[model samples]
Target chain A: MNVLEIQGLTKKFGNFVAVDNMTLNVKEGEIFGFLGSNGAGKSTTINMISSLLQPSAGEIRILGKDSRKHSRHAKTNLGIVPQDLAIYDDMTAYENVAFFAGLYGLRGKLLKERTEEALEFVGLGDRAKSRPSTFSGGMKRRLNIACAIAHKPSLIIMDEPTVGIDPQSRNYILESVKKLNESGCTVIYTSHYMEEVEEICSRVAIVDHGKIIADGTKEQLKAIITDVKDLSIELKPGSAYSLQSIGKIPGVRAVNEKEGRLSIQSDAAVDNLNRILKSLMDGGAEVKALQEEEPNLETVFLTLTGRSLRDQ
Target chain B: MNVIQIAFKEMLLSFRNRRTLFFMLAFPLVLMLVLGTALANAFSTTAAMDTVRVLVQDQSSGAAQQGFAGFRAEMEKSGFAFTDFKPGMDGAAEVEKNNYDDYAVVTNSGIKLYGSDRNAVASNMTQGMLSAYADRYNAAAAIGAADPAKAATAFQPAPSGGYVKELSLDLDRMPGSMDYYAVALTVMIALWGAMSAANLVNSEIRQGTAARLVAAPVRKGEIFAGKVLGNLAVNMLCVLVVITFSKVVYHAYWGDNLPLVLLVLLSVVVLSTSLGLALSYLLKSSASGGLISLAVQLASFFGGAYFPLGVVEKNSLLGIAASLSPIRWANMALNNMIYLGDSTQVIQTIGLNAGLAALLLAASAYMMSKREGL
Candidate 1:
C-alpha cells in the first residue's frame, strides 16, 4: 500500500499560489525525490505532508490515517531532516539525538541505544559528546540527520538536507538516505542539486510554478525530452534562422541561437544531426564548435521552466 | 522530549550561560548592596531639614510641669518619633551641630510643630502627625484622671533629664544605606523585563532556534510553555540566592520567617518573568525585550524598592499601584515583623503580600497562555 498520499493539494497566500492542485503518492520503501528550484512550493508541499502547516485545500493520508484529524499520530512514524540544521547547538550531539528520540517517546535503554546507533550511522559516534560548535560544518550536518532518524521511523522526509555542507558530508548524507530507504523506510527528499536527485531519487518529480510539470522514473522524465538531446553540425552563418524550409525534418522540434551558435532542439539528435548538417551546409551556416552535448537534468529543468535551477 | 523535560534542558543551558548567570546573580548582588546601603544611609541621616519634631519646653512649675511626661508618652505611643529638649536650649545651633532631631516638637499652648522652614514635605507630614496625636491624647486626657492636677500639670509638664531617643532595631540588621542598597539593587527587574526580548522569544528567533523547533515535532504551545517555565526558574534562582544571602550573612530581617519571604520573592520573580516572556514573544526586536526588561526593573524602582512608598503620595497610579509592588509587600511584611518586634503582626502583612503575589502570578500565567500577538 502507498505509505503517503496527497490529493488536490492547494496552498494560497493572498492571491499568490504556493502550491496549486498538487497530487502525489509514495509507495512503501520507495525513495521519492521532491524536486524544484527555490520557491517552487517544494517546502510548502512537504510542510503540509509533514503536518507542520495546515493545508488551505487538500487531503493528505498518512499510513491510512487522515492527516487533518491525526497529525500527532501521523507524525509518530515519520522522521524529518529539516532544511536547516535543527540540532541544538548547546547540546552534545548524543544529547541532541537523545532529546529528539524522547520526542518520539523513545525511553530508557532504548533511547540510549538508538542515540548511539544514530551517531554510529552518521560516522560521528566518537564525537557524540562534542557540541555542534566544536564540529565542522559537515559534522554538524551529519549530526542533524542523526538526531532526526534516531527513533528509526518507518518513513523519513528530508528537506534540502545537504544544501551548504561540504562534499564529504553531502555524500555521506546521500548514502545514509539510500541506506535508510534500503532498510524498508519510505523517503521523500528535496534538493536544488539535480545531481543529488539523479543519484539517489528512485522516482523524481520536476515541479515548476507550483505545479508538478513532470513526475516519473529517471528514465521516464528523461524521455520527456525525447527530442534531440545532442547535435553536431557545420555551416556558415544564417543557416537555420527561418525553419519554414527545414521544419519538415522528420523529428526536428524548435531552434534557438545560443551565444552566437546555432542550437537545435529535436527528437533523435543523431538523425536530426544528419538532417541539420546536410541542410545547414546546403544553406551555408558556420558551426565552429561542433561538439554534441548529451542533454542532462539541467537542460530538462531549463526546458520545463525556461530558467536554470540555481538562478537567484 | 516531554515538555517538562524540554523545559529542564532549557534551564540547564540557561544556568550555564555566563551572561544569564551574571544577569541573574551578580547584577542583583551589586544592585542590592549599593541600593540597600544608600537607603540605609538616607534613613540614618539626622537632618532636621524636614521632619516634625515636637520639642516640649515643660515650664508648669513643680509637679504641674510634670504633665509633659505623660503627654510625651501619649504622643510617642501615637507614632510620633520625638526628641526632648531643655527650656533654654539652642535648637538651631543643635541642628547645625547635626544633632538633636530631624524635626522639633515643642509644646506650648496647644502644641508647636517646627522643622527647617525650607523642607515643605517634612513640615506637612509633621503637622499631620502632631494633629492626629493631639486629637488622640486630648480625648484621652478628657476621659478621666485620678488627679486632675497631675493630669493637667504633672502629666503635661516634666523635667528634661536629657531625654534622648532610643534606637530599636537589631544591630545586625542595621545595614548601612549601602547594605539595603546591595539588597535592593539585586531586585533589578531589568533582567526580568528584558526576558521578553533577550532570554525567551527574541533570543530564540535571533538564533533561528524557533524556526528549528517549529519544523520539529514540537508544537508551538509546547515551545512557549517550555521557554516560560525555564526562564522562570532562573529568575527565582536569582531571587533565592540573594534573599538567602541577605538573611544568612547580613541578617537584614527578612520577616524572620523564611517561607514568608521566599513566597513573596518567588511571587515577584514569577510575575516579572512571565511579563517579560510574554512581551518577548509579542515584540519584534530583540532590543525591545531588553527594553521591556529595563522597564520591569524601573517599575520596581518606582515601586519603592529603594525607599518607602508610604512617603510618596498614594494618589498617582504608579504610587497607588506601588502598594501592589512586590518589593513593597516584601518590605512591609519585613517591617511589620521587625518594628512590631514580633511575628504576630506579620500574619496580616504576609497574608496580604501572598495574596497579591497569587493574583499577579495568575494574571501573568493567563496572559502568557493567551498572548499570541507576534
Candidate 2:
C-alpha cells in the first residue's frame, strides 16, 4: 500500500505559485528522493505534505487517509525533519527528544523507552544529558532527526538533513536513512547533492519551477539521456579542433571545443568516435588524452532541464 | 496531555533562563526597596504638617462670639489660622475651593464644620479639635443651667493636655511608603510578564520549532494555551515571592484581605500576558518584545507603581495620566482593599482585567488563524 499520496497539489502565495499541480505517491517502505535546488518548491511541497502549509488546491493522503479531513491521524503517521535545525539549545538532548515525542501522546515509561531508542539510533545515547548548546553541528543535526523519529511515525520526511557536515557524519546519516527504511518506515529525502540521492534513493523525482520534471529510479532516470554518449578529448597545447567538421560526422549530434579540449555528444548506437577523432586530427588537433563519459543524474538533470541540478 | 507537556517544557525553559529570573523577581524587589526608602516622607500622613486655616462664619452673638474669641486665641498658638466669614461669603464653598482648610458656621442653634475630601488627614485633625471644643461647650452649658457654681469653676481653669485626639479618616490605617511600593512593584513586575509572553510564539517561529510543532498531532490551540499557562504560572510565582518578601522583610501592610489582593494581582498578570500574546500576533516580529517592554514601562510610570499618587489632585494632568494606566486600575483596587477596607473595586478591576484579557485572547486567536506563516 502507498503510505503517502498527493493529487494535483497546488500552493500559491498571492500571485506567486510555490507548488503547482503536483501529484506524487510513496509506496510502503520506499526511499524516495525529492530532488531540487534552493527555491525550487521542494521545501514548499514538503511543508504542504507535512501539513505545515495548506495547499491552495489539491489532496494529500497520508497512510491512505485524506490528510485534510484526518489531520491528526495523518500527522500521527508522519514525521518531518525540517531544513533548519529546530531543536532547542536550552534543553538537554534527552529532554528535546522526549518533549517532542510526548507531544504525540507518548506517555511515562513507553515515552522514556522510545526517547532512549531514538537517541541511541542517532548515536547520541551517551550525550543525552548534554544540552544542544554544547553540541557540535553534526550532533545537533542528528538530534534533530532523533526528535522527529522518536514518535515512530510510519513515514518520515528528511529535508537536506546532511547539508553541511563532515564526510563521516554524512555517511552515518545516510546509513541511518537506509536503516530507517529497512525498518519499514518510508522516507522522502531531498538534497542538492546528487550523489547522496543517487546512492540510496530507490525512486527519484526532480522538481523545478514548482513542478516535477522527472521521476523514476536512478537507472531509469539515466536511461532518459542514455540514447547519447558524452565524449571528452584532451588536446596537446597549440592543438586545434574544428566544431563544424565534428558536427558533419554521422551520429555526432552536438560538438563544442574549448581551451584545446573537445566535448562531443553523439548517438550511443553509432560508431562515430573514430570519425569524430579523425575530424579533430584533420583540424590540426593533437589528442593528448581522451575519455568516454557515462550519463549520471547530473547529466540527466542537465539534459532534461537544460540546466544543472544545483542551479537555482 | 500535550498541553501539559508543552506547559511543563515552557516552565522548564523559563526557569533555566537566569536573565528572565533576575528581571521578573530581583528587579522588582530592588525597585520596591529603593522607591520605598527614597519616598518615605511623601507617604507619611501624620508627620507632614501644614497650618490649619479655618474660616469662621459667626451667625450668633453674645456667648457664642465670646467662646469663639477664646477658642481662636488658644488655637492660634498651635498651627491654626482663623478667618471671619463675611455675610455674602460661602464658607463651605471656600473650603471646597481650598481657600480655607476648614469652614465653620456658628449659629444660635449649633456649630457646623465643613472640610474637603482632598486633604483628609488635616480635615480629620481639624474636625477632632472642633468636636472636643463642642463637647466642652455643651458640658459647660449643661452645668451652668443646672449648677452655676460648678460652671463658674470649670470656666475659670480650662483643661490643657490631651484635649484633641488625632484620628485618621483617610484609611483604617494609612500605608507608609514601603507599604505602598510593595503593592506597586508587585503589580509592576506582574505587568512585566507581558515581555516574556510576547516572545512565546515568535521565538518558536524564529527558531523554526514552530514548523515541527505545527506538524505534531496536537492542535494549535493546545500549544498556545499550554505555553500561556506555563508563563502565567511562572509570573504568579514571581509575584507571590515579591508579596511575601515585602510583607516579611519590609513589614508592608497588605491588610487583612490577602486572598482578594492576590485575585487582583492574578488578574493583572493574566491581562499583561494576554496583552503580550496579542502583541506578538499583531507585530509578528522580534520588534514586538521591545514594544511590549516600552509599553509596560510607560504603564508602570503612569500608574503610581514607582510612587504613590495619593496626594495628587483628582483633576490634575498627573492624575489623568495615572487613571489611564491599567496598572492604576489594579493599584486602586488593591489600595481600596488594603486601606479603605473596600472590595468593590476588586470586582471591577478583576472584571476589567478579565474582560480585556478575553478580548486580547480572541484577537490573538483570530490573528493566529489568519496568519500565513508560522
Candidate 3:
C-alpha cells in the first residue's frame, strides 16, 4: 500500500502559483526524499499533504484516505516534523513530546511510556527534564523529532529536520530516520543538503519552480547525466588559459574558469582529460593540481537546471 | 479530550513563562494594593473633615419653635451645619443647586430628611444626628415630667417638638476606596485574560508550534477551544488569587453573596477569553499583545474600571460608549451586589456578558477556520 499519494497538487497565493501540478507517491516503508531550492514549493507541498494548508487544487491521500475529507483519520496515521524548531521552548523535552503525543490520543501508562521511548530513541533520555531553552541547537533538533514520532505514526514527513545542527546530531537524526523506516514507517524527507537525501532516501523527487522537474532513485538521477564528468584543474595564479580551445576539445561538454581554476565538463573525462590539460599547457597555464569529479545529485541538478541548487 | 490536552499544555507553558505570570498575577495585585490604599486614605481623610449641611424648615408654632434652635445647636456639634429654610421654599431645588447637603422639614408630625441620591452619605449622617437629638430631648422630657424640680434643672425642650420619622432616601452604605478599587481592579485585570488568550494564540502562530498543532489529529476548532480554555483557566485562577489576596490583605469587601460574586467573575472570564480570541484573529501575532494591551486600557477607561461610572456618564458621547463596555456592566453589577446586596442587575449583566462572549467566540471560530496558515 502506498503511504502517501499526491496527485496534481497545486497551490496559488492570489495569481502566483506556489506549487504547480505536482504528482507523487511514497510506497510503504521507503525513505522518500523531497529536494528543492528555497521557495521551490517544498514546504508548501508538505503543508498541503500534512493538511496544514488548503490546496488550491489537488487530492492528497494518506494511507489511502483522502486527506481533505478524512483529515483526522489521515492525520492519525501521519506525523510531520516541521523544518523550523517547532518544539515549545518553555516546556521540558519530555513534556513537549508528551503534549504532542497526547494530542494523538495516547494516555496514562501508554503516553508516559511512548514519551520516554521517543526521547530515548533520539538519545535525549538524560536531557528529558531540561527545557528546550536550556538545550543546545542539536539537542533541540532531536527533541523536535521526538515530538513528532512519539505517537508512532506510520508515515512521518520530516522537512529539513537536520538543518543547522552539529555533525553528530545530524548523523544521529539520519540514523533515526533509517531506524524509523526499518520499523515499518514510511518517511518523506525534505532538505537542502543533497548528500543527506542521497545517503538515506531510496527514491527522490526534485521540485523546482513549484513543479517536479526530476524524480527517480539516486543512481537513476545521476544516470540522466551519466556521460558528463566534471574536471577541475588548479593552475598557478595569473596563468593564461584559453576557454575557446577547451570548448573545442572533443568530448568536452562545457568549459568555465574562475580564480585560477579551470572547470571542464566532458562526456568522457578519461578520453578528454589529457587533451584538455595539453591545451591548457599550450595556453601558458602552469598546472598546480588536477582532479576528476563524479556526477552526483548536485551535478544532475546543475545539468537539468543549468544553475547551482544552492544559488536559488 | 483533545481540548483538555491542549488546554493543559498551554497552561503549563503559561505558568512556566515568568513574564506572563508577573503580568497576569503580580502586576494587578501590586497596582490594587498601591492604588486602593492611596485612594482609601484620601477618602477617609476627606470624610473626617466633611460636614453635612442641613436646611431646617421650622413649622411649629409659638414657644414650641424653640425646639428647632436646640436641634440646630446639637447638629452643629456633630459635624453638621444648619440653614433656616422658610415655609413654601423649594428645598429640593436648593439641594439641586448645591446650596445644602440636604433639607429637613420640621412639622408637627415628624422630622423628614430629603436629599438627592448622590448625597446619600450626608443625608444618612444628618438623619442619624437628628434621631439622636430627638431621643435625648425625649429622655430629658420624661425625667422632668416625673420630677418637677429635676425637670426644671435637667429637662430640655424636645428637639423640633417632633419625632424623627424617616430619611426619604436609600441608606445603602458607601463602599470605601479600597472596596471600590478591589472590585474595579479585579474586573479590569480579569479582562486582561483576553490579552493572555490572544498572546497564547499569537505565540503559537509566531513560534511555528501552531503548525504542528494544526497537523495533529485534532480539528482547528478543537485547537481554538483548547487555547481559549487554557487562557480562561489561567486568567480565572489569577483573578481568584487577586480577589482572595485583596480581601485578606486590604480587608476589601467582595460582596455578601459568595456564589453570585463568583458567578459574575466567571462571566467576566468568559467575556475576556472570547475578546482575546477575537483580537488574535484581527491582528498580527507580533502586534496582538500590544493591541490587546491597548484594548484593555481603552475598555478600562470607558468602562469606569479606574473611577466611578458617573465620571464617564457626565459626557454624552462617553456615556453612550461606556454602555458598550462589558467591563462597565460587570463592575456595576459587582458594586451593586457588594454595597447594596442587589441582584437585580447582576443577572442582566451576566447575561449580557455571556451573550457577548458567545458572539465573540463565534466570530473568532469563523475567523480561525478561515485562516489557511498558522
lDDT of model number 2: 0.88
How many clashes show up per model?
Answer: 63, 0, 1
Worst 10 residues of 3 chain B by lDDT: B152-161
Docking class of 3: medium
Q: What does DockQ come to for candidate 1?
A: 0.21
Give the per-residue lDDT digits (tens) of candidate 2, residues A124-185: 99999999999888898999999999999999999999978888889989999999999999
Listed for each candidate, the true contacts retained, as a fraction, are: 0.20, 0.75, 0.83
TM-score of 3: 0.80
Off by over 4 Å in 3: A234-288, B45-172, B309-315
Q: Looking at model 1 chain A, which ten-residue stretch has the lowest summed lDDT?
A: A232-241
lDDT of 1 by residue, B80-173 (tens): 5566677678766664454533444444346654455554565566667557556645654664355565454423332554356566544434
Interface root-mean-square deviation, each candidate: 3.5, 1.1, 0.9
Residue B304 of model 2, lDDT score = 82
lDDT of 3 by residue, A1-312 (tens): 888898999999999999999999899978999888888899899989888889999899988989889988998898989988888888889989999999999999999999999999999999989989998888988999999999999999999899899999999999999999999899999988888988999998988889999998998898888668988889999888789998998887667677888777777534877788889889898999989887778778777766666566
Per-residue C-alpha lDDT of model 3 across residues B1-374, encoded as one tens digit per residue:
99988898878888888987798778878887777777676545244447888887878653235655766776687688888887678998998888898988876546787886778888877777778756665565677668757754543644473667666464356777888778888888788888777776778777889889988988887888888888888878888888898899988888778789888888999998898878878875567778878878988888877766655644588888787777888888888787777898999988988999999999988888788855
Best lDDT among the predictions, by candidate number = 2
Give the runs in model 1 whose Cα sits over 4 Å from its true position. A231-293, B34-40, B45-179, B189-199, B202-221, B249-251, B284-288, B305-310, B315-374
Ten residues in sequence with the least summed lDDT for candidate 2 chain A:
A303-312
Tens-place lDDT digits, model 1, residues A1-312: 889988999989889999999988888978999878888898888877766667789899989888778767777778888777776678888988898788777899999999999999999999988889899888988987887788887778888889788898899989998888888989998888888988998998888778999888888877777654655343455554445545667765545555556555566634666666667666656556676667667667767776667663
